[model samples]
Target: MPIEIHQSDPQSYAVAADFLNVADVEVVSLQHEFGIFGGNAGDHILELVQRLRTPLVTTLHTVLAAPDEAQRRVMNALIRSSARLVVMAEKGRQILQTVYEVPNEQIAVIPHGVPDRPFLDPAMAKHDLGLADRTLLMTFGLLGPGKGIETAIHALPALVRNHPKLIYMVVGATHPNLVRHEGERYRDSLVALAADLGVSDHVLFVDEYLSIEDLLKYLTACDIYVSPYPNAAQITSGTLAYAVALGKAVVSTPFWHAQELLSDGCGMLFSFGEADALSTAVAQLIEDDSLRSAMRTRAYARGREMVWPSVAEQYLDVFSKVRFERRSAGAMVIPFPASVGEHDRLPPVSTTHLASLTDGVGLVQHTKFAVPDRRHGYCLDDNARALLVMSELAGLVPLTPQEDQMTLT
Candidate 1:
């Protein structure tokens, strides 16, 4: 179905409600940011969610560890109004459960999506980027306070001491929100820090926003990717996710998302805002070829689950589940097939079909020609049909005494 765009000013409640009403959307899907909830804007979203008759599915961008009263109220109300809530990480789901007391069933874990790209060797990628001699370390995002780019810069002197050919590339403009408020103070601070540390020559800042192709090029060229974000509660990091997906050896601060993704040899984690720890983590990967290769392999394997196609399928699954639940909630009948009764008058069906259709679990839902197709996965409807057929066959097959007792029990 084609979706229509309905724009509204979030700061104004009447405007938002008017746009929502005009759309008459089946599902009110929201991409929420907790920071936007600081003013009365949060209430506007909550109000819209409540007033709209449509089902709601919210993809939460920021799941705060500590929420104040208004924040909690808004988040709780959003959860109550939404048919399902989508979070990018298991840690985000856990926080919602423990902190907001949201029901487990209402929450869905869909990883932040990454573009599918063929894995390329960093050396080959670097040759293309004209940085074949440099061991590149990078972090790219719209920069602002709390990104902890300063920590990465501070760590550069030590990293440069061990590997003089290392270059730390900070690829992004100052975040628009931060620029609006602080106007490059954070970027200037980072530049000053680099200069003071005498590693100014080694740090490269590509101060332009990258297109997806450009971003992927830079990501493919890096020896190691570093996310030095300072916030422990931070739930999503697209930059880190991309690097991990591309199989770059990642060293990151222990933010919620990083801790979850980088565990068990996938990548290394250091304490938040600890430049020394960042340096050591990077040094370990730099010094050991085998260890870095292993981490890269593990990172690549784990990232396969989060590629765009897989993530899109997961989103579709959630949408299907929510749509089914909404439609079935008011339904009175189970809607079984009418042809089921005709099986009695016709000659008995051969078990050959059933035998071919059976898997270790149960009967499969789909078929390719005469053969079972398991690619679409199992369905309860098909399994239910199998159970009904088995029950009818029970009369002809006499059960032994022990078998009879087990069946009864």
Candidate 2:
């Protein structure tokens, strides 16, 4: 169903809620970004989620380190309402725990998913694009001021002096939001900057939103991928993820996502808006074949874990767990006489499920109903706590044979 919620109209949220209630969806997966919604700090979403009849699993695209009062209020309400939360990076998980006081169990750190593409020689890809003679350096995504394309343009003059065949390709159209307000001013400024620097011949702008197939082709053709985004707080970048998964040698600024994904020699990082530094890093990668090849290999190896099939499985696991919990919570309710106190009506806890989760290594991190899911693997943090609990239980009471087996495992 394609029910639309008007961004600025508060009542549209109520209508959306009503539509979803009748849509027969067992679960709702919301892709959340603060700016995409309306009202003060996106409070409009709270109304929709509050009225939702289906279980909500929110994937947070941006997690601010420090939010203002209104943002904090809205975030807290959303967290309280959601059945589960998903963030792309560990830094976002840290912010949710320390800054928002969200519990660790509520947040799932699934990486930004990317297509699984085999590594290809850039020269062959460049031949298909009819640019085999030139060395391509590319940056893609919606064009906007925050993307810092002018910095890349400024660096081109220095780069072109040594590698005369180098061409800087700025792919994608101007961002719709930027076009709505500022019209093409940011993109024009970049073009004029390149012209002023006398490197206009070296810059190519593919001004359209590309389909996935075309985007992959462009990414494969590029010798180096550049991300000059000035913002350090950005929590996710699908383009950056795609580049890494395709085994491109990436040169990026130290944003939150880039810093984490590019660590351990996967890619090179330069300071934000530093033309000389960006130029130097790109030049080094271009000059050293062994270093560039090694970086690509490491990046491709790490990306195997982030490919679409693996990411999809992780998402399905989260959905299954949340749906089961919702159903279990609904089934636990029973009508009692008014004289019955809340404490007296509580149900006894069972260790059956706990035992099922434990294995030879440790407790599996997640489950689908009673079945343990090994896809998530075991965490040392969880194992340490399990050990502590077993130790405490042994001191207080005699361990059952089954419990002894668990401790041994």
Best by TM-score: 2
Candidate 2 local lDDT, 102-218, one digit each (tens): 999999999999999998889988999999999999999988878888889989999999999999999999999999999999888888888899999999999999999999999
Model 1's alpha-carbon lDDT is 0.83
Per-residue alpha-carbon lDDT of candidate 1 for residues 1-409, written as tens digits (9 for 90 to 100): 4333233444454455456767755566788885554345366566567776667789999887788787777887888888999999999999989988889999999999998887778998888988999999999988887888888998988889979999999998888988999898888988898999999989999899889999899999999999988888889888889999999999998888999999988999999888999999999999999999999999998899999999989988888888778874668756776675766465544566766777666767899988888898788887787676655656656545533332332
lDDT: worst 10-residue window of model 1 = 400-409
Pairs clashing within candidate 1 = none
